[model samples]
Target chain A: MIDLSQTISSNTIVYTLDMVGVAACTIAATILAKRLQFDVLGAFFVSFLGSVGGGTLRDLLLNRHPIFWLHDLNYIHFIIGLSLIVQIFYHYVERLDKALRWFDALGLAAFTVIGVESALSRNMSAPIVMLMGVFTAIIGGVFRDIVCRQIPLVLQKEIYITASLVGSVYYLLLLQTGINEWLRSISTLLLIFSVRMLAVYRGWNLPDITLQPKEKQK
Target chain B: MIDLSQTISSNTIVYTLDMVGVAACTIAATILAKRLQFDVLGAFFVSFLGSVGGGTLRDLLLNRHPIFWLHDLNYIHFIIGLSLIVQIFYHYVERLDKALRWFDALGLAAFTVIGVESALSRNMSAPIVMLMGVFTAIIGGVFRDIVCRQIPLVLQKEIYITASLVGSVYYLLLLQTGINEWLRSISTLLLIFSVRMLAVYRGWNLPDITLQPKEKQK
Candidate 1:
């Protein structure tokens, strides 16, 4: 049986490591997205967004002080490490983009769950929790997209944010049933990933509500 | 003498118009920066950051409610206007790049003074207000540079942040002396613009903290 205190300690360790993973994954995603034209500095910005943007937004919303970063400089080291990794592994990502797609989905799923759970622990309202979940899922990518000068995926005509919303709500509902923590974590991750993957595969999109152009032009 | 309330109102109008000017300047900035082959979506992203990123970050730190755009949809309209202006009047900016450079400096000066006023109005400490002033002045350009795949102006050994810091401190010093708002604003703006322009012309940069390799790589 895993002791609860040990579980908490282990989770913290894993989270910090996973943050580094986010940085690395962000670099891979941007490199692939931009087709190798993104330079070292661009890769660094993407990695920073991938690793830190989501958590930073979460902390800001929760009114947490010092941020996860302003206190410990480990994240800075992680970003540097990830940037070097990209410099070394550029060819590998270019040659194998498909596998990285799946990797990106898994990363997104894991991050969504973590964000939603963090909000719930702070006793946020359900809507706020869901918003937090969506914010967490997209902010890193959104920041990356902004820095990359691309339309944010959330604003794109796709089911991206919707999939995140569905998964967040499902996870919260399951929690009400007294599910085991580990199982809940795994299952929610699976749910978010599958839903998102399916949505992407299907080209699902929300209804467009574009404002019609006013007359008076030629 | 100007009525105090009318003066405040006029400043607010100027503040709002400056926001629009910032937006227009951003879109124009990106179109020029990416005159080479580029992703158009990324261009809009750069415009968005250059227009709103600084103020948004300021609000986030200040713990204000309903971020500026969320409160009034005018910012959204401003963005649309920028996009349209770029699509139509881009050639003009290209023709005037040399002259427009000074306009960019003016925008920076105006933004730094306005940023200091905003922070001080929120009752932030002088140091924190100065920091906010510097942040607002540089973040937009820093963001634009990163997305354009270049080192940020401040990070590139430029005098960008230095100008903002000087201007902000000067603004505070003026306030301490009971200087009238209009004169104080003009002096601060001139100080920031002159310092920044002089540094750019002179190629001034703080020394880079270089570290020699302890061991040579083969």
Candidate 2:
């Protein structure tokens, strides 16, 4: 089998993966909207937020101009088209929770790497770059959940952010070892995707920390 | 009484008003945190989000660099110091809900004007500028409420966003009349403050639109 990563430039691979990630996020959000019984407009809005909100925030934080969606109308067009299609097929699409998790995992992996690359291009330090990676991977979901009036999933006792953070640190370390660019990208993406999927499959969760007050004497 | 607006440059007036707005928003958020019984760190986070979140979102949308808080460390320092003080004085401050509404109104007015001016500087169109103004006035509270896991107040039946939108349109019209800079600023400020306070005092609300399904035959 031909290795696509070996044949394609790293930028092209990343860009393609980013598009897939955006599409996956939009689909997942559309399913959520259906479950929430949001109207067509609400579904469109949530899907847009889920697909682009994180990168938009990241670009703003890094002072990147002409935000990604505005700079290329194709992303907007794609989201609008996909949201409409998903809404039209909501009866069938709403039952895809099993598939939705996989799409979300793929999005998490792709967005983490994309965020890291974006920050790296801006010459950010390692810690900030890793933070950006995690931010990019999870913030759109946070925005989606916030708009839905629920606590963000990442902020809950989920192993989601941990997977993204570990993958980011792993990618950073890989950069130092002078690995093949495509290999590094693919390997990091696989690592995040596997970790997230495994967490979901095993029902892994971060321990919830609650501070208890000292017991008063009766 | 001396007209301080007349003595100070319009830029300085806006700058000073911006600071007042920030402090007011921070204090309002701190009061909210006290009611919620959040820890000090949570209080600080909420206050920071309340004070700067709107403008930061606006600047990012307009593609302005370094973000307003990052460009001036004073905003950060001020937020931290004010949040800490408010946390310490929670016993007294929490009882100031009557006073809190006034501060919230003042912030809405100031931030609306600041957002308008920032957009005008960017040479945006009238409608977009007005939107920027409304966005800047209310997004912080939206952020704060979303974090607290509630529907944003502006999105509710409250007359809050209406006040910001009307003030923005009024300010835009004033710009056409070529009025004295201070007079324009002061008058517009008063208009928004009055509109908001009046709405609060009268317990006015926007009509909530609910689409009713056609009655089915029994």
Candidate 3:
């Protein structure tokens, strides 16, 4: 296993940007919890779960110890601080409806890049790395939606996992090019964010499975 | 960080019983997928996930490498073999309506004991060990329900996690008595299975959260 603390601490830009994504996700969870009329404790739990659920799954699957949040107390404090802020500004946030979409897209993109980098550093296969990237970007939302009793948007929404997969592919290609790491990271993040935003704006979606009458007979 | 291979290979009965639990969960997933009208790939994925999801989480949290299923190829083969059998006997299994509950409870009990033993061997704190035991028992079903878009029964239905928790507590207490290992294991397993079966039969449930008028104001 890579020394995650050393690697993450050394990459100041990526680390900072990744925390921004975590914050975005936590805020989104808080908003969802508010809409669902959850109490303060419930809201905090949802926010914390959404922020770290995917990474927790990833770290667990990868057999990494202490988990990311447990390794660094900063993540927990950041989530708690943001959850409190969301509660305080609840009314203001309710008025800014589009904020959820934007923040969600940003977090999706940022986490995809981070996921790709983490998996790539482990020298996993391309397909596995891409899957891990998409998993990191979407699994948190999946867990949050499930707890909220909604079908996970990632499984049903317009062009969600596709954007993450594309971004991961781009990052892997960038790695082969041996370019500046910072530039590659930024490019991958922007690419996913743009794709996700464009998809939401234009209502792009991967084709859903449609049952064919003739094929069903077989 | 326990030598899972040595432990599992050494215990013939627990190993066999654990596989039965895995098989039961996979069968349950297959039945669920059929109800949801999933394709072959989706059904296989769900079955595989449901069978291993909880144990995967436990192993991950415990920082165990290669994961349990990955460490042993037999698990993969068993799930695949059982899945195929379910596909062939789908209608027969459907006719056996009460089979789901019985199989699920049995699996839950078996997995709980296995989880407790795994954690106990590592000398973890008692509370953590009990939590892990309950977690291993319930997490698979939670994942299965989430993917199938149903509210997880563990979160809503009868005295499920409570039974697992009680059983684990019993196992922990049994450790203090210095009894035979097999006797301790069997007692824990029987205690959980009987509690779950009795609860389902008696229509017992944990009290759900309900807001009172006075509490709401506070």
Best candidate, DockQ: 3
| Candidate numbers sorted by DockQ from highest down | 3, 2, 1
DockQ of each: 0.06, 0.12, 0.13
* Model 1 residue pairs with clashes: A149-B42, A150-B42
Q: Per-residue alpha-carbon lDDT of model 2 for A1-218, expressed as tens digits?
A: 97866666877888887888899889988777766766554566578788888998999899888677654667767887898888776666666769888988999999999999999999999999999998898899888887777678787767888999999899999999979988888999999999999999999998657766678422
What TM-score would candidate 1 get against the native?
A: 0.54
Q: What is the DockQ of candidate 3?
A: 0.13
Cα deviation at B178, candidate 1, in Å, is 3.0
Q: Order of candidates by lDDT, top first?
A: 2, 3, 1
Say which docking band candidate 1 falls in: incorrect
Q: In model 2, how large is the Cα lDDT of residue A79?
A: 85
Report the Cα lDDT for candidate 1: 0.68
The models' CA-based lDDT, in order, is 0.68, 0.83, 0.82
**Which residue window of length 10 is worst by lDDT in model 3 chain B?**
B37-46
lDDT of 1 by residue, B1-218 (tens): 76989588758755754674485457655564446323233344457667767777887888875456544656656665665566455555566665665667766777777678778889999899998887777677776665555666566677877888889888888888977776787788789889878887887787767876868533
**Complex DockQ, candidate 1:** 0.06
The weakest ten consecutive residues by lDDT in model 1 chain B span B36-45
Tens digit per residue, CA lDDT, model 3, A1-218: 89777566549867877897898899989999999999988998999889889988887776667788887999988998999899989999878779788888899999998887777767667766876797788788878887888766565546787888899989988888869777888888889999999999999876423333454558
Cα displacement (Å) at residue A187, model 2:
24
